[model samples]
Target: MKQLVFGTLPSRSTDQATVTMGDASESSQHELKGQLLELSQLVEPAEVLHAYAEDYISNTQTWSTAKDKKPRLVLRPTTIESLCRVIKYLHDTGLDYKVRSQGFGSASATDVLISLSAFDDFEFYKEEEYVILGAGGNWRGYYDRMEAAALDWSIVPARTPSIGIGGSTLCSGFSWLSSQYGCVSDPANLLDAHVITTDGRAFWAAEVDPDLMWALRGTETGFAIVTHFKFRARPFPENGKLWAGPILIPRTKVAEVAKGIMSMAEKDKQGEMSDRVAMFLYVMRKELLAFIGATQDMLVVHAYDARGEAAGREEFRWALEMEGAVDQTRGDMTMGEVGRLQEHIGELRGTAEAYWAPICLTGEDEISEDIIKKSFGWWTSMLDEPSSIANYGYLLYELFSCKDNLTGRHSSAWPRPVGYKHMLLLGAGCAPNETKEISDAAKRSIMRGPEAILGKTMKEVDIVPNCIEDYHDVERIYGSHFEKLRQVKTRVDPGDRLRGWIKPSRHESG
Candidate 1:
């Protein structure tokens, strides 16, 4: 993976840690290979394989540069007992192991890698009003099963249906339903979880440890290797479909279009805009130069509603009333259909290196056109870069209502600041081999543009709802709950075997 460098900032630290090399002794490689031989005999049929250098090169390549570390030994476990035994053996042997689920980021890299591909379990507990899923399961698979049942359910729609349920849920996943239900791991939807901690102890998160359960929902990677998730599912809307789609905007009218969207969001805080409506605005490079003889960049307005088309139209009247629209794809569609659309586009951008830095805002202040226009301008600058991957990025606006999760029986790991209304996320993407200099500069501009607009330094505003970008302070990511999470981590992972790109608060001491 290409190295990521951040500008000289006071509070933030540079990330330099790479994948661990197991047993760093001079003869460590040979010793580890021998140990694997013993491991294979202990768990027959469960493969403990050693790879050639060529195998390392092939397997190390992942969705993006962020997760490019190669593991020495790849262990594929077929049963829960086998997996637990592997962990205990690694613990007893002092070997560092990392778990992989869909292979999206740096967290998958370790000395001994445990791939959960064989743990692909998915089942619907219709009588229990929940779905039990293996940690390795994908959203697309879950959707297929739900469609077969012909039942409507509430899911924090995966931005692309290909994402693993384990990784997304662990990060306090964002979803299309977030505005209505908070995050996907909003405690209410997370019925229970099965996890294996660093101490070689395995149990359900709820029955054994409540604090561990909170850590599991959001600040997840450092706590345990979650094997199963029993998520509380909700029935689909009465229409069996939700009104949703994206409205394309020509670059010239970005500011004009944004004012209306922000106005609606601000009004919604006061019960003026219907809770049924959730929308986000983004700028993508693919949409640029698509029109004939136009150097126009593209701004997209995506809205989804459960209250029907009339209410949905009224909700986005500002954008609908605009004089010119590049295109609009709006309709009543099933949840599965939405996932497929996301999957199609998501696949296109899968190989590109991506970064996310989201700054949240309060409901009390009005979102001005100046901030919107400035933000878009910052996003447009990257288009000048030579590489399409480096140039392809977006400025996102997403709204979140904390009402439901706030009133629930248990507290969620997702931060709900008083009067917090929405988020301004700056996403920067680049090709795999893009030069570090180009990618770093692009990331800096995207990360700081919003801070400059909001008249706050990066240190003042905390970035929450992270999606693979680990350059910021993790303490800021978890905020006041960092200490509580740290306490839980101390209890569950005393050996510090479980690690990820998202550093734990304890790392601050080093």
Candidate 2:
């Protein structure tokens, strides 16, 4: 291995291993040696094992990038048992390793420190509505199998048809239909997972306990090397549609345009079980336009297109009509018709790649103008500095509420207002390899900017949920329930293999 610098996240460390690829010179090295020796003896030596001694490594940087890492050895284990053997060797040896899902091409959008180039596995059960796919399976491939049966399913697949399904689900994740269905993760579809620990033990991460389920979404990746995932069943829309391109608006009214759309969107959120809708906005040529659509609900799109376009135009006119702007049909489109849509995702992802690479922002979906406005500003700000005209996306501020706003399929906790005036106020930015400076600055801008614009009243009026298990930063978002998640992590990964993303757990040792 070259003189690559690897830091222990949340902290930093130097790899003396760079010298002899040998154990540390003193105590740390001795312990490391013992562990490695023990681990080596347990597995087939590099010379004997057919799957051992192959070179591999995972990095968010492209191979051509200056910061990329080259591995000492790469191994390909075909069966779960072989994987287990491989993991055990690493675990006992205390080696550093990263697991990846092949199609996770986040490098184009975010500063993805890892890639699936060295990892590739895709397996799913077609008829069962349940699939045990490797982190590498592209959602399109997974969808092809599930969609055939008209499956109502959800996975945090990449924005483009080629994006991998793994990293998107576990890290820096979000969703389009999230407003209607909850975070794609809320479907309760992930049934089980196969993982490799840092110390290299192989284990199945699934529990009858709900605590374990919560942890599965939030912290599993760091604790274990996820090889494959089993998902719960979900129903897919009859067909899928894209609401098409942007509804142009002048820059001055961007804030009002956002607020007005969100006000209407909030008003529409009523019944518990309703069709899903998502709205995304972007700024190009000094105009603001939002993209609205669904990945599975193709039926209501045309009606929604007219409805949303009208609503947006009205909001824009009221918000910016005095500015006197021209309305142009940017374009009409579908996700399947990839061309620029894919490129946009690629472009958007490219922005993220340059900024928020390592810190995974898990998300949830709820229909609250407050969350919509705040989140759009928050997500978009991360990339505003990256481009001359910042491209922001993931403005999925559509409402899922129906006629019975206060009442739903299950229940209610928030005080329902007669009509919470709102519409989708937002944007999404995708780029590859976003620097820390850029991501941090964007976070501050959006985190504080929205409150000043919307005031605290809107937050009280809207409900912000996500497409994953996260409760945002509310600490109480899940409301005293996250304890269960910690408990689950402690149980399945007792040794604390989950900390590969960070340092090993304090409670456990390597």
Candidate 3:
């Protein structure tokens, strides 16, 4: 395996020509496109798509249409050799470029876009108890492959099927198995990565570069383009069959549900709850229950227990037996089925612009019913706004036990606060026509709920890097790790060629 030598490239030439989308002349743009098309012919199975192509249009679309940008050209490289050559060309010419796998984040590029969708390879090693996965595919595809193999084991990754394995893993994946297995990017789970650096050198980060490997784990995508990942596999609990599903309760039962959640949080704080159990509560419009002919505000409790059906039933008995329960869909489900539970909701992508921020509550403080009520109230306010884009949104409370078993391994680049038992995701969605002022106001309003509950201002609260708005302070998100990550960025991506959610620091290393 080849190794990456840090800080080996000479400084970029002062006279190098680069075309940016905003200032490129028509002739320059035409020349750039011609060059890209010619480069595609250099490698087998490589192709280039212009903006007019249907595939190019669809590939550029993102979950939030607000983040979408039209790139001059899209490059699809199936082999590492092709990918390396393309990247090297782009770097040498100082061309602005970005890499996309699933395009789930707010990051966008306007000059050149490299699509990794062709590298969707999967390989399992039964003897080694590990798997090598390509970066291009989503979690749904990976789960399907696992089920097809009929293997009793699976790697810990994203909870949502539509999420890309590469982006999620690199950003510190939170999963149904996270309570038991730390995070997908934890050293125990993400064993290695195959990365292509800014200089276009391909190498296995784990084989010869521990510093780069540590940076790749949860560094949030500015360091390099990771082509593949090597993850440690673990046996699924109870042969991969878990008891999981949603229990829907009408608005009339909101108080009761809040009490149940408070009780669960208390138990979790006391370490009385099993690590195998994970629960999520969603406060949203009753439209989700339209299939059942119900229309009203709804509170949904999605509960999962890695243990068998009997144990899961007992663990979530409060939710099943709660008064005014409109529906109980909990039952035995395979890991893949559980992961796909939210796929229908995910289909709303591209229809609305969304903003997200995370609130993590540590065990030092007791769970507050006031916080739950306030969060629900915010959701209600959004829906009640007449003819407003915020009418369709959700407040999700993710509750799980905290078990820190990966203490000895290298810490993740994502600064996940220690001892956090509850993670609250406040999301607000609006129509594409909504004015920037209104959208910004709605985004600011969502944070007020958590602020009221924690009795602290937004700056005083620690934000998780997993789901953040574009305006979020990067330094605050990375916390104490920001400086170290900046150093790595300066060393590896000094030219800042790769466009990502986080940009490299402007100050160069000494």
- TM-score of each predicted structure versus truth: 0.85, 0.56, 0.89
Best by lDDT: 3
**lDDT scores in order:** 0.64, 0.38, 0.72
Arrange candidates by lDDT, descending.
3, 1, 2
Cand. 1 TM to true fold: 0.85
Ranking by TM-score: 3, 1, 2
- Candidate number with the higher TM-score (1 or 2): 1
- Tens digits of per-residue lDDT, candidate 3, 1-510, equal 223222232222233222234557887877765565555554443256655556765456677767766565667676787788778887776456778876256455776778887777787777778888888888888999987875578898688887677777787778898888887888878889999998889988888677778888765687889988888887786544788888877777777887887777778768798888888888646565677777786678888888867888887778889766754555667888888887775576677777777777664463577677777777777766544545646678888833453854337777576676578777776787688877776666666656656777666676666766655666776777778877778788877787544556785322
Worst 10 residues of 1 by lDDT: 1-10
Once model 3 is optimally superposed onto the true structure by TM-score, how far is the C-alpha of residue 51 displaced, in angstroms?
A: 4.8
The residue ranges of model 3 lying beyond 4 angstroms of the native Cα positions read 1-46, 50-54, 364-366, 401-405, 408-410, 447-449, 501-510
- Give lDDT tens digits, candidate 1, residues 375-473: 777776666766664455667777543335644524866565655557787777777767888677656766676566676666666565555365666
State candidate 2's TM-score.
Answer: 0.56
Better of 1 and 3 by lDDT: 3
Worst 10 residues of 3 by lDDT: 4-13
Q: Indicate the residue-level lDDT of 304 in model 3.
A: 85
